[model samples]
Target: MRAYNETWIENKNVVSQAERWHRRSLLTDDQLTAVRKAYPVGFQTMNGFLEIGLFIFTIIATGGVFLLFVELLSIDDSSIFGLYCLLFGIGLAILNNVLIRRRQFYRNGVDNALVMATTALMVGGFNSQFLDDGSLWQWCLVALPLLAAVVWYYGDTLITFIALAVLYTCLFDLTLEASFGRTLLPFVGMVVSGLLMQATRMIRQRAYYDDAVSLTQWVALAMLLVSVNYYVVRETNWLLIRSTLRRSGVMSPPEIDLPWLFWLLTVGLPIGYLWQGFVRKNRMLIILGVLGVAAAVATIRYYVGILPLNVHLTLCGLFLIGIAVGGIRYLRSSRYGFTDVPDEDSPDEFLISSDVITAAQVAAGTSGHDQHDNVKFGGGKFGGGGAGGGYN
Candidate 1:
């Protein structure tokens, strides 16, 4: 189902676990090296800065070549231009596949850039060539399947986000055109987002798909909140209604139906998310919950301006600081598998200092038996550790 090598993916996961163990001081330097040598990952990757630089470079290079081709051919017609774009997109897609299969590029900038360009070109070309009088929703309908296919093949997080966005746009536009659409749109969005959230949650966890699935789930959660958010519902409804009224030559202020229901959702959804976050101990949910709360506050301030913006912001900041300080203090002792203390075993910590690991490895090699004797063995989240086969 995936384009990348399965064995390499498994090896990459093993290496990740080994790195975590080494960071936690549960794996000896020698053991870490042994694990690395035993399970090798062939995927070509880059550091964050390099990846971004290469991504930009790839886009620029490809765009330049495309423009040069268009200039040389002197293609001016929309149909011809669309045909060229389709050809270019197909070429890029093939190149992407070649890079992945032959060079084992995974999340590397070249592959990422190619996939993105391919998607954009294909969608643009299709719209230009085939949909002369089509609506925006119709265009989005065309894009949704292409984006979904790209996501399934590449499992790119950004592509997944684009796919979700297209899906949302399609739904929104379609629903807005229906009978009683203004009244039903928000609820429809809520229902679809809720179903999407559940679907993502039930997907079988795999290394290749994990990031995409997580991103989809997060987007679904956000969409669900936005669907019921008072400001969003009211503003969007007003805008649509205003447009319709302008078309009909009727200038009247729009009023939302069931303002009370929207208000309840605006206040209640955030609290629900916050409670669910704490209960599930999900960091993404907690962060979204905090944002939801901010949105709710903003909505209130938008409608009813009792306090000044600066005063409201200052109070919110102070309240947040107080909560953070109190929560940290409360979680200092580590209750219910949660703590204020940072995990030494975290993957982020592992990436921070390769030199430290090298120095420790050198010291271990020099001290030999003494270092082995001094090594601590204990129960860890990974397993009872001494690096022997704990990672295995």
Candidate 2:
């Protein structure tokens, strides 16, 4: 179901781990080189900045070509235009496949851009042709499957996010028509996000889906917090109520039902997240928990106005700094597998090294070179250099 070689993906993981070990002084330079040779990742990738630039260029080029083709053919009819879009989208999808299989383009900008363009054109074409008068949920329904298929094939994190958004839209839209839709909406979101988090946790051990699953877990955690957030629930409910009231010629300030419940959820959810995060030692949860607390504070200040804005912000900043200082001091000696010091075994070390090396290479004007060249730090074989050899 995947486009890239599974072995290559596994090898990429091995190389990343090896790179981390080498940075930690666990593996010598020669051993790192041997590891890279043993587990070669043949995917053609680019530096982060270059990837973004190329991605933008590919999108512009593809869109320009499509427009030029349409103009040259004088195709103006809506249905005809839709057909052309579908055709172009299919062509781009094929091109994407060719790039991945034949050219060995992995998450490089060109492939990423092609995949994105293909999804957009396909959805837009379908909408223009058959769903012109359809509701937004219908459009979302059309996109959900397409996005899921793309995720299955490419395992792209951005595409996964888009798919999750579409899925949530469809879920919420469908629920909105139920007898007590608005009241059930938040609970529904929470339940779905929780289930998704659980599923991702179960499957995240798989190397092929690791990145996608990890991102999904983070998103799910955030959604779980947002599902019952006071500000979101109040604003969204009021918007719905305002529309209904205006339709019925009733103009009054809309009030939310079960305000106390939302308030409790807003205050309690973050604490719960923080507790679970620490107990489980999950970094995503901890980060989201901190963010959730900040959001809750802002929500409270927006309504309560206990202190001046500047004063509140200053207090919050100082409080956070104090916590940071205290935590660092407390964790200096390590506690329950947690520490303030950097962990050499952490994957972040390898990522940081990769970024630094890529930046250095770019600054040195040595970004372009043959893959067969023996560069430093396992270059041309692993650790950000172009990996050679055919995909199995």
Task: Indicate the TM-score of model 1.
Answer: 0.84
Clashes of each: 0, 0
Q: Tell me the deviation in Å of residue 75 in model 2.
A: 1.6
How do the residues 1-392 of candidate 2 rate in per-residue lDDT, one tens digit apiece?
67777787887777666755776799997886687678767666466677889899999999899999999999989999999998999999998888888877877888999989998898889789888888778889988888888888888877987888888999999889788998899889999999998888676376676667876776677778788777778778777778877888867545577889888988898889889989998666676677777777777776776788778868877998999999999999999989988774444554556666455334433322111111111211111100111100
Q: Can you write out model 1's per-residue Cα lDDT over 1-392, one digit (the tens) per residue?
A: 56667666666667666766876799997898787678766665445566789899999999999999999999999999999999999999988888888976777788899999999999999888899889989999988888998998888878998898899889889888888998999998999899998888788877677677777777787778778987778778878778778888867546588889989988898789889988998766776677777777777776786987778778877998999999999999999878988774434353556446435434433111111100111112112111111111
The lDDT of model 2 is: 0.75
Q: What lDDT score is found at residue 365 in candidate 1?
A: 38
Show the lowest summed lDDT stretch of 10 residues, model 2.
383-392
Cα RMSD (angstroms) for every candidate in the order listed: 10.1, 9.1
Candidate 1 lDDT score relative to the true structure: 0.75
Model 1 scores worst on lDDT over the 10 consecutive residues at: 366-375
| lDDT values for all models | 0.75, 0.75
